[model samples]
Target: MAVTRWIAVAASVLSLGTLFVAPPDAPMKKTDAFLDAETTGVLGIEATECFDDPAYSRMANDRVVIYRPCEESADNQAFGFVYAPDGAFDRPAVAALGWDRCGAAFGKLWRGGSAEGLDFYPVLPTAETWADGDRALMCVVYRPGGKLPGSVLPLAN
Candidate 1:
């Protein structure tokens, strides 16, 4: 299957489900380091390579890419992001809006036909993060059983 098709599927999956309506634990600060740590945890990896993109350069948003050496059981090239600047990350409605924004971003990528074999989910900011001046709605992406050959930026264009 083409990679863009998989991205489309991932975007659809994100819209169709409600995996996290609220933070499961105590609210944590959503800092750059914290976002990277969260992304690493979501991708189930020890470390990741990340950079900033003008596409997501509004507010306090950030984007992260996951690259691993490679394993037969898992192909590990994927990317995710937390976007926007707003208050009230702890509110369920706010989290829902973040999810919607994330889905919209992925939908654009899918329409451009430059993505493949991906899965994604959104992460909500907590009150702590909000209090600390974090207003990002995050989406983390990964491939279920395949790895991406390169960065997702070109595909986004």
Candidate 2:
């Protein structure tokens, strides 16, 4: 409870906090706002299953904490998806491409009623559109600790 003891404790906490405490290890993707904004412009999100890599668990009943698949669409009919741990919102879309969060475009996507998220490709890769469209899509939720693939783009907000 002395001054020096308190200072040491605070310093220790800070050191541990920065060194030890960190964001949960989750699969991430990137979307470059300047280059790949079309695929990264997520306007909506839809919840799917919550499961580990190569498997999934149905969390349909849990509304408080649902797994939302980031539904993205940009100009020229581009579509993409990003996974959300909690609820869905446009702010989350911004968060997905923001500097703090993943800051990358999500990979592995569910097209219509497909089984895999990485099955689809950029709809209009050669098109020229600054904004994005409004389309419902599902993105691949990569396994924790897995690095982004070569195809996935970085999100720059």
Position 127, candidate 2: lDDT: 24
Give each model a TM-score. 0.43, 0.22
Distance from true position, residue 119, model 1, in Å?
A: 2.0
* Cα-lDDT of candidate 1: 0.47
How many times do residue backbones clash in model 1?
5
Clashing pairs in 1: 3-115, 3-116, 4-115, 75-146, 75-147
Candidate 1 lDDT tens digits, 1-157: 6899999999989976766566455422221223432332333432223222112323435444333443322333233555555544446676566557766766765554444556444555556656767565555444444333444433322
Worst 10 residues of 1 by lDDT: 46-55
Model 2 residue 98 CA deviation (Å) reads: 28
- Evaluate residue 24 in candidate 1 and report its C-alpha lDDT on the 0 to 100 scale: 50
